[model samples]
Target: MPVDFGPPRVDPFEQAIELGAGRVRRLRSVPSGPAAPAPVQVRLPRQRAGNCTTAPVRRRPVRRPGVPSAAVASEVARRVSDRRPAPRLRLTRRGRALVRTVVLVALAIAAIAIAVSSRADDVTPVSSRSMVVTEHDTLWTIAEEASPSRPRSETMAKIRELNHMPDATVHVGQRLLLPAP
Candidate 1:
């Protein structure tokens, strides 16, 4: 088996010098009529990108197959800086304005509906009665006088429900709003 060694290098200058010196020594011993043709210097044409006359647009090598990782990392960092809220969907200006207007109008509608409903309940019915209390007027006596057909306790309860009174006490000349008999 043979072991392989590295390649051997060759120098044209050494070969030419050796050949010329050998010829000179030989000519000293036996002179020649004419010297052989001298070694001609040859140059190799170097292939280079700079030498291209009409160079094509060289495209940059793709570092990734999909979106770049650096951009993704930057976006994630920006979101995390604000405590990593849920990823927000993108919206155009017109779409954002539309959403804002819709929310505002909905709130206004809710407020209006609440106000109208409250006012609807505030309208006093014609069947209800109001009495001005004289001196020594009590809620029980008034309930009995106001509703002779109904029970005194029941009338008092109805009066309390209507006038929002927690007790049966009444001040002198205090106008009391009573419910229907």
Candidate 2:
């Protein structure tokens, strides 16, 4: 089977209508009445390159009681005499001293608390009971016998430190100081 395609056609009538409509619109827009009025003439003052002219400003005269017209300048001067620059803010000697005192007091309070806690921890009570080692006696058995209230590990550490034992081994007839609970 073979496919068939139609041929394209260009129309001249549509182009002729568009050109005629544009000509008619241009002819109808031409002026149909009298001309407009002429603009008014305005002259501006000539300004020098160095001189600038400002708008006229009027200021009311300041009147003061018992003052002559010539004294107006002095009166204005007296009115603005008290307008001084603002004072700068700076810490005074007394203010600095107060701040230092506050810091010192805070540090003293912290130091006192630390000292009291350290002293309390250093004052571990020593036990009154002592143990005498015999043959084949272990530190574990001595700790159990001397300070039964304390944990076994704590009692062993105390016994080790008090007797200054190099090892866990103990000879016969050795004395061991027991620490308090």
RMSD of 2: 31.0
Which has the greatest TM-score?
1
Model 2 lowest lDDT segment of ten: 12-21
Off by over 4 Å in 2: 1-121
**Cα-based lDDT for every prediction:** 0.68, 0.66
CA RMSD (A), model 1: 20.9
lDDT of 1 at 136: 77
Backbone clash pairs for candidate 1 read none
TM-score of each: 0.37, 0.31
In angstroms, how far off is 46's CA in candidate 2? 99
For model 1, what is the C-alpha lDDT against the true structure? 0.68
lDDT of 1 by residue, 120-167 (tens): 998866445699989878888898888789889998887777777888
**Tens-digit per-residue lDDT, 1-181, candidate 2:** 9654333232221111122212311112223448533332222223344566564322345677776775667888887996888898788999989999999999999999999999999986766867778987888888888778888888898888877888878877877777765
Stretches of candidate 1 above 4 Å error? Answer: 1-92, 107-128
